[model samples]
Target: MFDEGVIKFSCEWQKTEPLAFSGLETLMGWRDRIFAAGLIGLYPNGIGYGNISLKLTDSSFIISGTQTGHLLHTEPQHYTLVDRWDIDRNSLHCTGPIKASSESLTHAAVYTLDSTIQAIVHGHSAALWQQYLNVLPTTRASVPYGTPAMAYEMGRLFQEEGLAQKRCLVMAGHEDGLLAFGETLEQAATTLLALKQL
Candidate 1:
């Protein structure tokens, strides 16, 4: 879950920055909704995966750190910030020493491919994953994560499911997990919740 301090900090950061009001409000609103929905967890089968992030600028974005959970309770400054592949440093940056989530690259890819997408949420949900596995052809066995290959596979599925308007995908090999993106964080969160209810 998100810390109160973090939520407050995020609110302040958005107010001080040149970001859009709707996007920031959506991000903050989802932070609360995801936590209240009990979507973040630590147990093996628990829904402990996923992060929400917002674009700070065209070439840069801010995302929750690895395993940080959907609800960020800490200060916003504590969250990780990532940028396009450096023409020089060759690595992304984070607020602390911790590495960003492996799926960070996936988030980056979504933003790169869809300029309208302002928020991205990725999580492991038993219900959604089960649906994907039950529906996917048996010939496909494994699903990749945090890799370009996985992104491509998901992109194909998105097309197949007529989900381009929805912008969400479930990974059959990854199990009980899915990724959702939207023009705002609220939309992404709402889509994820809707899938879980189904």
Candidate 2:
């Protein structure tokens, strides 16, 4: 299996200063909550296990930096802007103090589904994944995470599985991986939280 937290796409990163916290306030707040719940954290193997993103524009977004999940709290530098991406090319461009999360392309896939979708929260929960696999809009177990194939699965779900209304899905190929998204950060965060009760 592909290791968690590994970037599968060709990333073109321009290291720069951290972003201002003005637009990231809400995103960071929910991040802290999910981290506290153990949905986002470092595995015993030292690899991180989750990421979140906020759409900045039609083609850009602010995503949690790779490997930052171990931190109890993250600063502005822990996030990076995905300036551009090409799903078919399996490439991404980003800028900030740190590189974008490995899951950036998957988030990019979701954002492209609707301009109204503003936030995406990707977390790890074995219970949730096990309980919801195939029940929720789930990507194929043969399709790995953080790659163009996985990204395309999002499109399949939207077109055929009613993912637009469900707003959350399971990644069967990526152990414990779940994605929740909505027009606002709160909605996305709340949707993720509600999954625990299912």
Candidate 3:
């Protein structure tokens, strides 16, 4: 109970101006659809689940802020920029009106794995997780979410489990957790949407 939305890393957060909404139109639009689909939403415990992110550079990205899943809609202020992260140290540095999402490090791991991966969508769905668990490149259940172990597990998936080609994997230890990523936000979101049909 109450396992989601807690930041597991040492985050250096700076309160700054809200991010401009210009380049986020596509991300936000897909987020709206994902939330409406009940993929990213509030749990009964009031903890928000799921997060969306886009690569801004090789080392920087914009992600929906932590605990923002309760919102039916989000604004620029609800997002943050993760400018730096050290997965081995389990540390992150970000700037925005809000802190980065709890899954920032995991997203950071994905970006670090490949230069072409430009977007990542982390969401929850019992059916999808159950149906695809182990059938897809999956993390071991021993690794918890938002930690260096989990981040490394992502690397394992890519190096050993063909995750880059699969483009999605189940977080076996993280209940109902699934991540989809691609070269574009559209591909990332569509990958998750496609899983709903299987």
Identify the leading candidate in terms of lDDT: 3
TM values, all candidates: 0.69, 0.97, 0.98
Candidate 1 whole-model C-alpha lDDT, 0 to 1: 0.56
Q: How far off is residue 14 in model 2, in Å?
A: 0.6
Model 2: lDDT to the true structure: 0.91
lDDT of 3 by residue, 11-121 (tens): 999999998845688778888889998889998888999999999989899999999888888888889999989998999999999999999999999999999999999
Clashes of each: 10, 0, 0
Tens digits of per-residue lDDT for model 2 on 101-170? 9999999999998889999999999888899999999999999999999999999999999999999999
Cα RMSDs of all predictions?
7.6, 1.0, 0.9
Models sorted by TM-score, best on top: 3, 2, 1
Sort all candidates by lDDT, best to worst.
Answer: 3, 2, 1
lDDT of 3 at 132: 96
Clashing pairs in 1: 2-71, 2-72, 2-73, 3-72, 3-73, 3-74, 6-74, 6-75, 125-176, 129-176
Q: In angstroms, how far off is 34's CA in candidate 3?
A: 0.6
